[model samples]
Target: MLMLLWNVLKKFDLLSLDNEEEIISHLRRLSDDENYLLRDIIQAYQILQDCFQNITYQHLQLVKTVVEYSNVIEMMKKSDLYSTYGRRRFQELRDNLTTQFQLQE
Candidate 1:
């Protein structure tokens, strides 16, 4: 599964896409796993697309922050060490990814 993900990411040139529909189509073809590692990547890409709609920057620190944050979140998604509280926090983060905390309590 991890290998499949790596292969997809190696060829995933989402930034060059000109339309959201094309991106969604590509994501749909990625994999059928519901909560796989791709979920975090999918949501992160969408949120970044929406939030940074007009920003154009070639900053190194920001790029590092995005990559590091995504890597840690992806690891957390597959980690089994989350206790009850930790699981809840993880869920909250997941929810925020899609809803941006607007619909979360």
Candidate 2:
């Protein structure tokens, strides 16, 4: 279900390749949705991966906001989705973010 939504977003250039502000804004909107689901969180993680590919100060700030402001990570930890491919991808995002943050420090 969520994956389908991601594909649509991707088809429209709403995902990772879009502007950082746009992505962050979309994420913020998603986080605010009453029906926000695991797919939304997973999409955010995938966007983070995209942001990491072209690391910038703005992108870094977006990453920080997603990590610090959202419960996505904790949700991921609790979700059975973690047992699937999502888990590995989430871990990669986590590790990449940690490394990026450390290097910034």
Candidate 3:
């Protein structure tokens, strides 16, 4: 599932596509159990979301990168695995992204 999600995000150019097959293979080897897989996916999503939401403009390129990943963040909110807290955090991120885009305009 994480691989699927990553593939979708990669389509939007939010994540690197390099060695994708190898990454998926390693993720599969890391977890044969469904619960473990789900947990890892959720944790990874949360961490990435938080990172984008808390981004500072100390480096302009980093800010631009986070903005580019906003589409991936938006898609993540649609996942059934997204918890209530995750939904709230996503909303906050969405608002922040909107503000950033507006400022750019």
Winning model by TM-score: 2
Please, what is the whole-model Cα lDDT of each candidate in the order they appear? 0.54, 0.62, 0.57
Candidate 3 lDDT, tens digit per residue, 15-100?
Answer: 33665455445446544555556667775656445334544456435545555586776677566338888777878889999999
Which is better, 1 or 2, measured by lDDT?
A: 2
- Of candidates 3 and 2, the better by TM-score: 2
* TM values, all candidates: 0.23, 0.29, 0.25
lDDT of 2 at 10: 46
Q: CA lDDT of 31 in candidate 3?
A: 46
Cα error, candidate 3, residue 87 (Å): 0.1
Native-vs-model 2 lDDT?
A: 0.62
How does model 2 score by TM-score? Answer: 0.29
Clashing pairs in 3: none
- Root-mean-square deviation of every model: 16.6, 17.8, 15.4
Top-down TM-score ranking: 2, 3, 1
Q: How accurate is candidate 1 locally (lDDT)?
A: 0.54
